[model samples]
Target: MSLLLEREDATLEIVDDSVLTICGEADFDSAGPLAQAGRHWLAEQPAQTEVSFDLTGVQIASSAVLSVLLVWVRSVQRHSLRLNRVSLSPALQRLMDITELAPLLPAVETTCAEPARDRR
Candidate 1:
């Protein structure tokens, strides 16, 4: 399913290997789009497979970005998906660290060009 958020500078798209590339600003304004698109992706996972979010493209954001990722992590766990290590931006890592959600999302620092790996 294509759950891309349509905006002037932001987007949420299925790039490859079930990785959703969330680009641009993810502030309170974009939070709903992120959450809605994310839940759609999570619910559609047919098997226990990794789901990655390439957040390297995020230029600006707020805690809503973390909220979106946290919700996705919870949905994956609740659905018994084989998900882990959501590729995140360094900024996002720092935010998660601040919020104490870094452990739950199992975030990794990597670009979207790199293979989205499900490192245990």
Candidate 2:
């Protein structure tokens, strides 16, 4: 895997030409740059490349993280790339479930070690 962008609390890396892995806290402060970099990277990939977003390393899965994910999703669509699956953290899965935005993403895989807790 090759490192693409690295901030203090977040890192975006290309697992291969086909998979992008985002690790750490993708907070509101990092959202804009993360989205822009992710979009640019997606735009550069060949259309035949199937894409996956690996967010299992993210802890918060805040709205900012979702925003970044959405931007990357749109970028993939615009580039005519196929989205395979989004590997998610437990927190991210919970956030998506709460927001009802799961359908906006492709197939999801909960990859984090900890399971999402029941808040209710």
Candidate 3:
């Protein structure tokens, strides 16, 4: 929707600290690739690694996304890995809340961090 600016259908990025960011829509058309990729990443996390799912840029989140998230949870448990955390935009947070799925995953409030200033 507006968050996508209709420019990006979906995007997947793995940033620093192994944060997996899923941008744009997390719908039927977009969930497959994400799930496939996510499974790969999740399989590798355990024994002192942290992985977070950053859905802050997602515009539309549907059952498809929710299902994928559920799969992630199962993966975490399956691998006995500690999920780092989940970061959600207000919209995504509300979507999870509406579906009563927020409690299923350990998510923290997505607050802006102060920019690091150069001390030169």
By lDDT, who's the top model here? 2
Taken over the whole model, the C-alpha lDDT of each candidate is: 0.70, 0.81, 0.66
- The local lDDT score (0 to 100) that residue 106 gets in candidate 2 is 57
Model 2: what TM-score? 0.87
Clashes per prediction?
0, 0, 0
For TM-score, candidate 1 versus 2, the one ahead is 2
- Lowest summed lDDT across 10 adjacent residues in model 1 is found at 111-120
Error of 3 at 91 (Å): 1.6
Across residues 1-120, which tens digit of lDDT does each residue of candidate 2 receive? 778789997888887667777787789988898899889999998885788888877867799999999999899888988888788888888888999988887544434344233211
Deviation from native of the Cα of residue 9 in model 2, angstroms:
1.0
RMSD of each: 5.5, 5.3, 7.1
- Compose the digit string of candidate 3's lDDT tens values, residues 1-120: 012112246767676757776777778977777777777777876654666776766667578877877777777777777676777767666777788876688544343222123111
Tell me how far the alpha carbon of residue 47 in candidate 3 is from the true structure, in angstroms, after superposition: 3.0
What lDDT is reached at residue 33 by model 1? Answer: 78
